[model samples]
Target: MALNSGNGTVPDSKLGDEHVAVQKLQPDAKIYDRLMTLSGFFKQQYGDEPEFYVRVPGRVNIIGEHVDYCGYSVLPMAVEQSIILAVGTNKQRAQLELHHLDEGKFQSFDCDLSDLEIKLPKTGGPGWYSYFLCGIKGIQEELNDKWRPIGMRIALSGNVPLAAGLSSSSALVSAAVLATGHAQGMPLDRKQLASISASCEQYIGTHSGGMDQAIAYLAKQGCAQHIEFHPKLKGTPVTLPAGSCFVVANSLVQKRKAASSDYNERVVECRLATRWLAKSQKLPNWKDLIRFVDLQEACHLDNDAYVKLIDQQLKKSIYTREDICEGLGITEQELETDFLTPSTQHMQQFKLRQRALHVIQEAGRVVKFRQICEQLQRRSSKQDIEQLGQLMQESHHSLRELYECSHPDLERLVALSAKQGVSARVTGAGWGGCIVAMCDSVKAASDYVNVLKREYYAQLPAHLLERYQPNDFNEVVFATFPSNGAELFVQ
Candidate 1:
């Protein structure tokens, strides 16, 4: 696929706005087939040509793990796998039409545009279309009085593996926001789109750290972005060391972050720990400092000193409800109301110290990771690789032991990677998804993938073996470089 674009172009997307460049994706090879198929699907579904299209790539975090929500910076780059949509303004009726190619996992949904509501399930992940509605609703609520929201006809096909920590869900929400904003003639800002998408995804019920949404809109080709949330939301692109290729390997064990309370439980624990430490230190506004970043700043402690303070103050490995309530001079009802999210209201032990330590140290690793890459600046050396690789190794160990987010399958991949002289770590929200490994070169990546195929994927039981074959190596593991974020295409 080739993109005919004007300014920093892409191999896809079409739009004629001032902010985004308008281009056509010419169908010259198999890479362009998905776009062509989606175009045909749009015609068959809506009986008209699509006005424009949106392409949102999924991302793979290189080093930072489980620290984005703490209001810290994260290093992530966009991948080739993406969600593409064929969109046009609806004229037949005031209804939004959403169609997905995967009929087995999803069914076509249509809803009235004038009255938009995202209905979430009581348990498990919500329907796929519910996420799309989140984007449309986000834009609809934000638009000024000059314009009324319009219905749209959309047909989307995504290759990003679902529930694999690839942010396939955030990709859809962002595509919907971009497509809808374009249809409404709204001047779209990438940062605003990222912020809105992050806020709206809460409708689907997960308190995410916004790294997925930020990279979805802010990513540029050939470099990873160091996105920060404090002071203001911003992204800075950093060049990776020369002669390095990062390989992402799926563990084949899926945990939907929204479906389980484990993710939210961690978020609550971090918040509770922040408040516990803040109030203990006699900060006047302890309740206001729910995030670890805020607590650290309030205490006026450097990163190392903050860790020391946590060690000295948060002495217990686990704190019960009564323990926290008594220490904070609050009742159980207040703790339940102020400290816990609805999903994490279950009475339980809290690993305040461990969770706080992971966020603090992992945050330090992100800064160090970016610094090492910046220092290398297209240069390469054995010591440079060791420095960068060591950081990743430590990150995974911390996630597994301290954060308690790594899964057995993920650790197995990490182990196999270690044998190959590569450093791998659990990358996303982490309860069993993907491990991103640092390879010295492209050839090294290829060899590492082969090693994993024989040691890991090849040993799967007959049931899973039927799903992943030897020939489908790219599906299980592949080398990904930085790619363009979100682009719009005009027909």
Candidate 2:
């Protein structure tokens, strides 16, 4: 059976019963050559042609940051960069053979599909294959009744930068899940796969909200999606301004979310602050509340009212562990086990006021950002466009100050972007990642790229600088628009 194709749905076409249809890449497409290369490599490695391939694209958040898990909407678009997998199933064996295009960087691994174990590192992050395993396990869990372990030889190739906050890891996991599902001939839907991908990623130990996976499956070409999570997982396509373009520039500093507690620590703080605010409002079962959005709904307040509530309830800028336990009437052990994530269970002070303030205010910004984009679609003008840019600037400031997720390199990139009159902010979970900057036109984007090359890339270490060519620096910085969502092809 063929998958449903909707306006914002993933483009997944299933093979016919005869399995004779062959999916071919468009000759003029940018990734056509790369796909052909991977197909050749798969033939050499597995000694046969692959059955099908999967493509999942990485995304760059335009404005929203660190507020998705708080149950707020985010505006993001999928980039041209993506992860591609070439697969061939072996019905006789129960093992999975995984290979990467870059053999030296990623070693090949074979594992039994029936018993998959994802081992988190004692320190730092899990191995690369752990992400793949997360996807496989997700599909297996979804198909529990009809699941049968099948052997598969897969070859992976990708251009998305690793750990630069561009959603590369999530894209890989999404691809793996799609590949596994297609190989098993199980029916798949975009929404269901997105939900599964988000939940299954926790196996690698990052408390992510579902933004990356949602966009990876629901994105459409030439449009940015306003994805809301509180009410439901739905994406509304927002047409960008006529002349404006978005440029992504990496800070070259990698932040692996699973390797450190910084990302989860923020998550813990937000949850604690939510409960604290809920109690202040005398809401029933306040202790059960974990997301700020839920508290807002229970209080029957708008975003502005919620911002005031943050100031009224969470008075103290910082709350110690003792203070939190006392306020909630819970023991420290309960707080550790129930409230905090395992990675952030250590003794520490929580910045309830700043974190909550950032979340509430950032949530408002997402609304305003979407509103401005909608307005621009109706009437595009210089002043209206500047208003959107100004909102992006405010977002970066809040992320840098209140959220404390921005890295020095990110701040520098933002500062440099300002010099070029571009509005930019840290895109993903921050702390060293790419910044998405909005420029007026293609020429304006070209000028901004040149400025960054001269001011920022020139200052890098000699070794790093030598690896990048002056003429071809598109990998580090490039202008992008929305692209199609995840796709599956049978050959």
Candidate 3:
């Protein structure tokens, strides 16, 4: 199953373009064969050669969780995993077919540019398929008459974890939009593609702030982008300092909110909070409240004159818990059971605090981290990797304490990395998912893995240990920067 032939081998040309030199997260021979077979079928069915391979990556939020929806900047990067779509175009009808590699199923929908009601099946469950369709639909809606309905066959394959806060759904939607745009011969650039996908994927019910799709679509190899979404979609890729290695560890605990059950409700709550805050301040929109301030202006919230002004504005629109619950369409009991606390009440309250604090602090850290990285990129004198490390440590603490995304396994992993002299934090949405650690050196990472294999494996849940026995230090991964976004393939 050579779906991605250059697995684990970095391409020399992947430095600065829409080319990703990443390892296939789950390179299955059978799945790859199924996907390629579908590609062949499309070629045979539509009489068009398979174009280039396009892979949109699944992202990891390094320091920010649930903050993007608050209209704040986020530190996230497209990981070395992606949803690979092998696509080709047809001149005949306006339709798109998705060939599922895992289930050996083919699901598709004919494109009706005028009819937005046509729905596609969500692969993971209900409304999932429609999200994928919505990306295409959004693009079609934008193109109007210039874009014709072109047929396409997309063979999906990837290793990005689903429902673990890794943006798997967003990747799928973005990949589909990319493939469909290419098939239709539209002039949709990377940013436009990302914006379209984000807007449509939002229809799937999560009021996401467009970070995942932006990183997935505009990602570059060897660089982590610092993205600000408020005033405009502006980003600059910050290069990593030499001798730095990143370790991403999956905690293997899946939370219920990630799937179709209760995740959408939390999004609603955040939106309600913003709207309430906006009205209290008498602002037209919540985006008006988002202000980019200097380091001095941001230090104190209560005493500082500027902070007082902002606080006064927010305090006016502060809603009671009941009001928030009603706006989000949930009862207090439902909120207590489903929204407020997924783990425990104590844990949930702690998480709400953590989430609020992380957004404020992390929005500040992004500027500092980028400045430090930029300084290192130019002059070798006075490198502040320690500052970056300290910020990462603080960010992780806020994530663990205030944001409440960190699980015990993630905490253990971070602690292990710290013992080995590495700085680490929970990546993505946390609460039993992956953690990204910045190792002092590759040797330090290796040492951490060796220690973790001895200590962490035995502590796993009995069910997981029995079904998937821990291999001492076996699944730990180390990677660097300069990854690509999606590309087209023709064969």
Candidate 4:
């Protein structure tokens, strides 16, 4: 079925049960107003109105942190904030033209769709357009030789704070993929799009484990998704407790995964740990196994059994590069080329034990978190709810100490959240980002926000504080519920 047409209506047949409801555009609506503003900008820039709009929301991982790439389930919800695009297809031209709404922040770029090139910098991060190119190239490759690349004029605007541990970059990449697919008349399958977006992001050098892209396209309103990976991509809507809500607060300490090797280094450590465990088990094809989940499956062990394996096998807190190479029986060159990511190739040390422990234990926490949410639906009790909160706190501790991914600012925010009676953990890829705090009641959430504003945002420089008005403080730190996933708005 055609996913979208010139008409404003989106057929439900095109959107299967895996996707969220599609809404028609109304000019007077707030969302439409923003789209129109972007469309106007597009017209001014390219001398033509946009054919359609695409939106993909940023996500906040509530309970699971850094375990997604380990091939485990994660609990995350889509944020209302997202990356929005106004796109007009150019059938005659073969170049993709991109314009950022914030022109001063990101310079505009035009590239040939048929010959896309994404080059990472020797140091620092790749250009912003490199991310867009990742998505475009992904769609091109997914379609194979059948893809007749089309040129398009695009204007982009986003409210998801950049490098704030929120999936802003992933959302942008997803939006780009959606726009490119729609422009080329490709099928719109949420799962397939999520998979393509996930794989495409690796082009820019971050080995993200499909969580951001999954939640970006799979999320439904009013419920956090318990997304499971491994056999296949699936998301089950998990309604949060009635009395509690989640609030996301940015530390304002930007952490771009592409800019630093910290995120990928942890990923490498987990992979090495997985291989070491597999080798210890003498499992066939142990050398080929990279993900912890895959190793766990190979062992046919339960969560507790896996925890025991960690204790018995991964005895050391740290494993030097030499130790890993010796244990795996591979030369440094082979290890660097085959196992390590481009960014983490320079790292000489690996925290195999700690990183592996965090992955195994954190995966268990995710299962427990989903189970608690399921239990709450049948019976809500104070103790059961507190158990869930305690798990969140434990998850944060493991992330901070075991994974060594938490930053001081994030720790301070988590500490402040604890004092406010909210159980919080650093969300996203950590190192420096936002914290997802769980509160018991709406009143409690309001009070928590106030405390954070006074204690956290108030301490910021006067220039930074001046940017936010009294009423607009919620933009930086406020309660959020599950939002609808990606959608296309056709005119």
Report lDDT (CA) for all predictions: 0.85, 0.86, 0.61, 0.87
Residues 218-316, model 2: lDDT tens digits: 888899999999788888999988888899999999999989899999998999999999898888899889998998888898988988888887888
Error of 2 at 177 (Å): 1.0
Clashes of 4: 0
Indicate whether candidate 3 or candidate 4 has the larger lDDT: 4
Judged by TM-score, which candidate is best? 4
Looking at model 4, report the run of 10 residues with the lowest lDDT sum: 2-11
lDDT rank, highest first?
4, 2, 1, 3
Better-scoring candidate (TM-score), 3 or 4? 4
Each prediction's TM-score versus the true structure = 0.95, 0.95, 0.74, 0.96
RMSD for each of the candidates: 2.7, 3.4, 7.3, 2.7
lDDT of 4 by residue, 65-173 (tens): 8888889999999998989999988788889899999999999999887778888888888899898999999999999988985788999999998999889999999
Poorest lDDT segment (10 consecutive residues) of candidate 3: 343-352
lDDT (Cα, tens digit) per residue for candidate 3, span 1-491: 33343432223344334333333433343234534665676565556665656677888766555556565667677777778777765577555666555544335444443355644334344344565676777777777778775666655566676656677778888887877776667754677787788787545545557888888877766778887776567667877777777767667766523244234443444434444344444444333333323222333332244334434433423345665555445677865665443323322211222233445566667667778888987865334988888888988887676555577778887887788777888776667767777776778767765566567765677876774454442443445344566654433
Q: Tell how far residue 467 is off in model 3, in angstroms.
A: 7.3
How big is the positional error of residue 432 in model 1, measured in Å on the Cα after superposition? 0.9
